[model samples]
Target: MSFKNLPLLGTAEIIGALNLSPKQTAAAANLAHRVTQSAWRRRPPHKSGQTYEEFAAAVSACAWLTMFEVGALLILGRHHDARILTEASRSVHQAAHTGRRR
Candidate 1:
């Protein structure tokens, strides 16, 4: 599958969709912002290393990692929690595709 086609979900949307407490949502957003900013700053110039597809995949992986961390911190360890996460991911994927088509 092409990683470039994957959907990108904002941190706020993920936290809100998961029904996390306001405080938790804020914390997750802050963490995501920090990590994303750091990654961008450390990334090599556009001419070097990975292609755009690879870079996007790396970013998606980072977002997934952040989601997992936030979920763990929020005690989202039940089956229902997994279901919610899956649903959120699917929603984001659909939204991305819809946007692309427009």
Candidate 2:
């Protein structure tokens, strides 16, 4: 059981995976769950439609959360929790050697 292979903290992939529908749901969880407003012209996407402008009047913009790299940043999370992976890996190792999932 070794956690030396893992590093903490990774941003989720959610750049343009959001949209609004024709009607609102009972509740909106996040920007992804917002409903579309009327007078919107374009081929509607699925309930959670997502898209951005291809051309702009000015230069294209680029933005992201700066917390991904900041002074004295310490990540307390993992893509897959190392603690759980250690146990699962140990189990797999045991099963490979002893033929048991336990």
Candidate 3:
């Protein structure tokens, strides 16, 4: 089968769509994962402790990684590593496509 149309590359093609070497892509992916994790872990501003402006200011004042960008990076890595998607098929049957002509 030709890999010309597997459609694995994610929506964020801004980073040249898998143009980088595998090692670089892998490192980017790892960084993306860490960023995602941190984003998920960050606590939302408390309901009573801070006003919207204060919360916004606090967040803006801190050095923060962009989760959206990191997510894109992860997608790039996933494009190269089909196994990452394939592994999901074991539990999520819908994720698998055998590419059979019916």
| Model number with the top lDDT | 1
**Could you tell me every candidate's TM-score relative to the true structure?**
0.36, 0.22, 0.31
Question: How accurate locally, in lDDT, is each candidate?
Answer: 0.55, 0.25, 0.40
Clash pairs detected, candidate 3: none
lDDT by residue (tens digit), candidate 1, 8-93: 45444565566777665555545544545456557878735765445545666545554544543445545576567657776888
Error of 2 at 26 (Å): 46
Candidate closest to the true structure, highest TM-score:
1
What's the C-alpha lDDT at position 67 in model 3? 26
Ranking by lDDT: 1, 3, 2
For lDDT, candidate 1 versus 3, the one ahead is 1
State, as a TM-score between 0 and 1, how close model 3 is to the true structure.
0.31
Lowest lDDT block of 10, candidate 1: 1-10
lDDT of 3 at 87: 45
- Candidate 2's TM-score: 0.22
